[model samples]
Target: MIQNTVPGATRTQAQRTAATRAKLLDAAVDSLVEQGYSGISTQGIAKRAGVSRGAQLHHFPTKESLVVAAVEHLVDKRLMEILESQPDPEYGFEALFDAFTGPLFDAALELWVAARTDPALHAAMIQLERKVSDALRTGCLEIMGDRVSPDIIDLGIELARGFAVSALMRTPESDREFRERLLPVWKALVSK
Candidate 1:
């Protein structure tokens, strides 16, 4: 039933549903930013979106569902932004650097910390991994323009995500020190 509203094509119910789903998704992300997963509630999301609880329930009836939607939304927004920001086709690897150095890393780190005890959040992250992974892979290939392998791109994503988790941990060293030390890991990943 879902279709794209195009000039000549039929606008299917699915498109409408997807748009509504995205609305709730944007709201859920706002909620997560306001309150971590544990602090967000279905009713709160519904109210913030100006939709009834039942309407929210139509897409995500439970906290896990809402969390999943929000995670998906976050991943998509980030990937799109990264993809859209290509300086030029010639500077593709720079895109990868830009992605790892920015908000995407912080956002994922926050989720990783919160998901340690929350299975639903953890599982939702798996879905996010797929999206992020694909975006990284495609973005890398586009920038590398036949120089980089998808396998290496995948490895880069994995290593970057791991660094994001470890770098933000409580340690005797200061956060700045930890970030300064993060270079070796990045060096290991990109150096071939």
Candidate 2:
């Protein structure tokens, strides 16, 4: 038999498999953000990831599984980022608001909107949303434990989410002014 020759090839089969799975999951999130839920499909995800369909199928047998896994992966990544950031003593609330309103929320909002009509997607999202929410709450507590009450943290989260949703309609300049006006209010509320 001819000897097999593969350059490097240090990664085991399992490592390769995990790397492919991660690629697929990341592509799924990109699809959700770019195309929304209705536009997402296994084939599209595989194509986006530059992986073979067989590899995608082997990793996630169904579209639901793929999307759910992507959502979980995205949430975990965002939570870790939030948890790792240094909390600014004076601007902690601003930092937290920015964290909650970034790309992670955009991806999640897309899923939530799509889930409203799709029962299977809704079920998957509901379970994952709770976990994401809890992780965010815990992160907030950790970041603001000394300065803010838990109840205020909860309220601030709701306020930030609402502001994020509403800010979509405002111009960047107006949004900046809006946040500037509201930051003091939020600081006062949390300080109590």
Candidate 3:
């Protein structure tokens, strides 16, 4: 019974459901980023999304489920960006770098720390991490194509992740300087 706003076009039940789910997932990620995992509540997320609490509950019965789904949604989005990007090693590297350093990573980081203490979240994250890892690996391979070695791709991804983790402690300017210095070396290694 969801209504479509598109001019003269109606959305199917599935499309409406998907739209509602997407809104909840997006709001969930925003809450995670703005208010650490411990601070977020389902009611807050529903309010953020402008959806009813009942709707949010229907989509995600538990907080863990919502958080995990939000991470998965974010991962899927980043993977799509990686896949659609221009086929160049440098461009691909930058894309992966952005993905690792972006809001998606921020939300996931919150979940990762929270999961350490919450058994249910830990189990959910373990599975989501596997899926996310596989997807990103596949994205790296796609970006590098057959020109670069798998080892090189792995190194690049790991380096990007390292940079992401490093950002948590380092100043933004400092992190940028480090990345600027290291990117060329990484490019040279992969280009070989």
Candidate lDDT values, in order: 0.68, 0.81, 0.86
Error of 3 at 190 (Å): 4.8
The runs of at least 3 residues in candidate 3 whose Cα sits more than 4 Å from the true structure, single-residue gaps closed, are: 1-10, 189-192
Candidate 2 lDDT over residue span 87-175, tens digit each? 65576677667865655777778877878988888888888978876876788877766667677777777888889889889998999
* Evaluation by lDDT, superior candidate among 1 and 2: 2
Give me candidate 1's TM-score against the actual structure.
0.68
Pairs of colliding residues, candidate 1: 2-14, 3-12, 92-143
Tens digit per residue, CA lDDT, model 3, 1-192: 656778879888888789899999999999999999999999999999999999999999999999999999989887886687555755777776887876899998999899999999999999999887788778877876777777777777778888898888989989899888988788877677
In model 2, where do residues sit more than 4 Å from their true spots?
1-7
Which of the two, 2 or 3, has more lDDT?
3
lDDT per residue as tens, model 1, 81-145 = 76676557545544654565544455455576777888877887787767777877877786666
Candidate 3 lDDT? 0.86
Error of 1 at 70 (Å): 2.2
Q: What is the TM-score of each predicted model, taking all chains together?
A: 0.68, 0.88, 0.88
Candidate 3: clashing pairs of residues: none
1 or 3: which has the higher lDDT? Answer: 3
Which 10 consecutive positions of candidate 1 have the poorest summed lDDT?
Answer: 101-110
